[model samples]
Target: MTREEREQLLARYTTGELTPLERERLFTEAMNDQELFEHLFEDDALEEALSDPAVRRHIMNTAPAPAPAWPLRWRWPVLAGLAASLVLAVILIQRQLTPSSDRSDEHTSELPSPCLLLSPL
Candidate 1:
């Protein structure tokens, strides 16, 4: 392979995109070429740096922050959904905690009878 072809192959190898046959051919060529061997070493070092969790984390931390998943225009709807969910949860909890009434008189006492209210008028 020419110098340019070797470099392209090296890139493919570094990115793990090379087939087994191509990898074998590259290594075979590297054994006879000092420059290709040095390129392989450099690629190995780069791969190691990329694979290390601490190095990856450092890279990620230094990178620019990504845009929010929900844009500003969508914020109100998201908040409204969250508020509705919270309200529903509170209502369900309140209903669950409140003791069920079996007494008819206790329930009747809360609302005025229509007939009694009409008689007074």
Candidate 2:
């Protein structure tokens, strides 16, 4: 491969996106070419920032301070209450539409259901 092609392949190899055959070619080229090996080494250094906690903390601390833990802890319970309310609403609607005869004391609607309009002749 030409110098530019070798550089592009080396960048892909550093990103771990190169196939095995491409990686082999990159390794072979790096061994024969000192400048390509230096380029790969520099790319490796750039990726080292991810695994370094000090750098990570410095980057994260630049943003606003995070919220307190209490709100985060209550988020699940709030979501569960909303879900339970939805389920209760659905059950109440279903009961109103088709109430059991055992509860005759409750005020029930006397209107003919719109459902009968969809019946086949």
lDDT of 2: 0.83
Q: Write the per-residue lDDT of candidate 2 for residues 28-119, one digit (tens) a residue.
A: 88889888888887778867986799988887889888779778888899999999999999999999999678666443455445664556
How badly does each model clash, as a count of residue pairs?
A: 0, 0
Q: Model 1, range 1-121, lDDT digits (tens) per residue?
A: 8888888898899788999999999999999998889889887898889989999999989999889887999889999999999999999999888866755568888887686445544
**Model 1 global lDDT (CA atoms, 0 to 1):** 0.89
CA shift of 49, model 2, Å: 3.2
Query: Ten-residue segment with the worst summed lDDT in candidate 2?
Result: 104-113
